[model samples]
Target chain A: MVGFEVDAVLGDPAIRIVVCCGSGGVGKTTTAAALALRAAEQHGRRTVVLTIDPARRLAQSLGLTELDNTPRQVKDAPLYAMQLDMKRTFDEVVLTHTAPERAKEIFANPFYQAMSSTFAGTQEYMAMEKLGQLRAADEWDLIVVDTPPSRSALDFLDAPARLGRFLDGKMLRLLSGTARAGGRSMFNLVTASFGAFSKAVQKILGAQLLTDLSGFVSALDSMFGGFRERAEHTYRVLQDPQTAFVLVAAPEPDAVREAAYFASRLEEGRMPLAGLVLNRVHTSAVPELDAESSAAAAARLGEEGDTARVLRVHELLMRQVVRETEVAAHFTDRFPLVPVARVPAQPTDVHDIAGLRAIGDAF
Target chain B: MSWPARLHVVTGKGGVGKTTVAAALALALAAGGNRVLLVEVEGRQGLAQLFDLEPLPYAERRLGDIDDDLRLLAVDPEEALLEYLDLFYKMGRAGRVLRKLGAIDFATTIAPGLRDILLTGKVKEATTRTDEAGRRLYHAVVLDAPPTGRIGRFLNVTAEAARLAKLGPIKSQSEGVAALLRSPMTSVHLVTLLEEMPVQETTDALAELTALHIPVGKIIVNAARPPLLSSRVTQAELKRGLAEAGLPTDRRTVTGLQSEAHAHLARQELEQQLRAELAHLKRPTVELPLLSDGVDLPGLQHLAALLRPR
Candidate 1:
């Protein structure tokens, strides 16, 4: 297997952004953090890692508790880490894009409050929004992004467009138009389907909810174009040669399948997929001792002896190694050209700088 | 043996085999002539893949060969919303018009918590659905719910929808769903691996679910691997054992095998520590062994047998 040159990506002066995306529980957050740390410590680059919903200990390790939405330097290193606060980022975008009164109105709207905080796609969209903001600031030599733990790996890529399309869709336009016209002009619209649409929406969501949503939409109407443009710009940044998308996955069926799906999706989108980081890969110390031979040796010795127990352990490890290899091979076989960096499974969870440094070393 | 709850909402961190666990649990529940419905809400069509069937539609279909009483449903928020409207307002043509105009998408996707409300609303319907004789149609309902990170908010439909709909059928429906979720008839079982991140998320989710007053059931430890060797075994013994067993006694091979054993023991210790921590949570814990060959129907049946109440 060809090794993914982690240092090449880290040391490359042209690559300004590295996006680590994968299925959840595959150590995407740790990968992003380690990459950022490596870029800072090894490559001597100013780097900031943006993590979305890191584990509590991982957050504490990165000093993310003290820095909520803004990047703060972790210890003395040039590495900086910040957990994404989606609502705050959304509010910041609104405040920066609109006037104070309009921002306040938008913030005060119930629907806006709900959408900003708990909307299904809000985190993904806001993560991208924050990424765009970070890149546009031009303060860091490299930026590493940890995509959100969405139900599907593709959600992080599809969310911004989905939200943008929803906001710019005709339904919202009609609703905002109705709100702007005080509900009278909807009847005067060109088509009866429009009336039926409004009635149906109103019937499902109720009259007050529609009013609140329209109020929120009208407040956000001026910024919808900006939202779409920013998403597209960030997307282009992702597609640029300067940015690299590293798909991370464990040597498991589900995670590898997700990585395959994401790799294809990135290819379809013309996004620069640098390589795949196969995390938590298991390997046997003795490649010569196959599982079958080890199991046979164990059976010959019986289970009570130390030699038998060692052989049993060797058998188990060999089986796991084979399983992991086969699972990882699924991805490598599908995408033969994609370089893979396998990070051996660590005995303990990574929650400190030394742990992250070890992971970077593994890469 | 009766289950603890009629509705079992299985949630875990992403990639933790919650869908597999839920399917197996449903199969277990459907044993002995009991009817069970396994629900998937994430639109992932995971149930279909698990059962080796085609992508399931909104309607229920029997999971053949596994258990005749076991059924599967992939709930779409759009379909759920339309059904809700038809049930409440009878807006048949208006629903079609809304679909044509993308209002359905707008309502389900754009409206905060509306999608979750609709999804759980469907689950609640299945849970409480009764027959002509006023008997429960399904003996058990297993929901392959959202991940633990959002399970609390996902199940808390009333509070989530309160911001969107202050006073309407949506509000009332969410209220009803919330009531059912908070009732003793429902249990939100958390699935986790014996790893740091999943266990941490499970702990956090347990705290959150407890605070939200949702009934939590067992803590399912999925993909648990047993300790292969005793901790007292020494590296010296392993080298001697390797030579005695006619394996290569070379430095590299011995060292490699020793290191692999070291990692394996270390991982077993870590798993033991995590298991102890989970035990401190005071919930009944069920540990499912790792399926080395990966999950298929027979594997799923094996898991179901393990999940079956003794």
Candidate 2:
């Protein structure tokens, strides 16, 4: 009734990259796995799904207790999955850019060290780097990704560019000022701060960080350029029509609004919009009683005092369903045309491949 | 414990100005003559930027003259990792090699919830200091915690990870950390904006905190939008205002007896969001004005002024 026709988007071959994105706890990761499963089993294409999420629940979804950075072959023909280890990958890239010595110096440098680990955009940039790696591998016919559920998902687009700017930014130059014009040593005053920090580091680690920093910087030198250039390539790859951005959300107002924001962002950035997936949809045809009836049932159970907890649970579930319904309606009104596929909530946690398969069959 | 040390932990959602708030609050408590140690996990160095100082490392540094007693430190994970390692085995040379290979990195970085435990460990150590300084070197330990989305998992990391590692330093540390988190002296503050998602997350966060036995001290509703209209009004007044403003009339527009009927509808929506949040019945709520820009030192000071016990 909301004009969401799912087949039209799914059957399109040009829809190469399906990005599953939404807020946390809204089943975004599970939905992504389902979509990949569907594409492989139903659509008959080899698919690889990459998740930028830090949550370790991916193993539970894939019927495994844990996963690593490498792609694990889950089922037959079309599905392969891997959780992106951004820091490890970034470290690898850093090692490729500069000489071992220079890389060590750079990574050990206090400023670069600070920016690499804790800066905001690094995750986004690293995600792009992962995308670039996957797109170039071309091992799969389709590539899917589950993005981090941050308010700034568009950072997926802006991250690489931001990183490039930062690497070339005045901040680096300011820090570099501490290095001689020949890039030999830091300025005198900064040396004192580093000295204080180093003393603290020595107090804590007994001069081990100095040695590790040296090794890390040396390895990072060769990897820096590759990381930057590949980030740029990923940015361009996302802009291509082959990369279809699927914005996933729940029926809730907040979830739909986040999806709407993502869609608007894709439009603003000229990124392709493939479709939308609305998971955990609830319908009135649940065969459940209305609120008044539920209240009566709860009161009756309480009066009998035999099954009071059961009746209370039923009432709570019913109320939650109604609220979920309201949230879903808000989403329907906002996103009009992007093909939306709805997956209803299940009675239990998705802990096995069978569960994932049932979710895939929702469409 | 005297006044400043009486309250121990400070926490809130990320990007809601937790680090800034912690910095300013530390400064305020220091101004009121208390030794405060502002700590951060996940190695963000946000405190350095907040105080307009050079970058802070794993060790604590005095944030001079924000107050004489106010101090800040960003506990580095690598440093924390070393101390943790040193407590158990001699890292001699091969241990250093293992650390370089990121063998120990898993303990801090990739380990499920271990980082959170270590992070909380730093705060707990700061809080429990009975050193002969008798000065109570840190009367308060303000922690810049992770964002709300993953905070439940962050704080509960110790208990959850401890379940996996039955008998190791990790387990012992986690158990010790969990005790401190569940203790009464620690108070959790949830910082959220007036927006739909943040408020919703705040509610979920409150439930999670309560379940974990973390006493939520207060809900700091950051960047709250001003009330555009009063609740007491009739349909006629709404219609007259809408007609005067030459706006379209619709059922959704509150009968359009006033100029801002449409805005009233929007306001009603916000109220609904707030109402849904209040349904949880946890902790008192405080509101702050929305700022034109992200919070800085001056802005944090202003916010701290509001947070001061009236």
Report clash pairs, candidate 1: A285-B256
Model 2, which residues run further than 4 Å from truth? A1-10, A53-68, A75-78, A99-120, A149-158, A177-226, A251-254, A286-289, A293-318, B1-184, B187-310
TM-score of chain A of 1: 0.95
Give me the candidate number with maximum DockQ. 1
Model 1 quality (TM-score): 0.96
Please state the interface RMSD for every predicted structure, separated by commas: 1.7, 18.7
TM-score of each prediction: 0.96, 0.52
Angstrom error at residue A66, model 1: 3.1
Displacement of residue B303 (Cα, Å) in model 1 is 1.5
lDDT of 1 by residue, B1-310 (tens): 3468999999999889999999889989888899899999998888887777888999998877853588889999999988888887788877777788787888877765889988999999999999999999988999999999989889988888887788877888899999999999999999999998889888999999999999999999999987876765666887787777777777787667667667778888889999999999998889999887788888888898998876
Question: Top TM-score: which candidate number?
Answer: 1
- RMSD to true structure for each model, in Å: 2.2, 14.5
Clashes (candidate 2)? 37
Residue runs of model 1 more than 4 Å from their true location after superposition: A178-190
Question: For residue A180, what is the lDDT in candidate 2?
Answer: 45
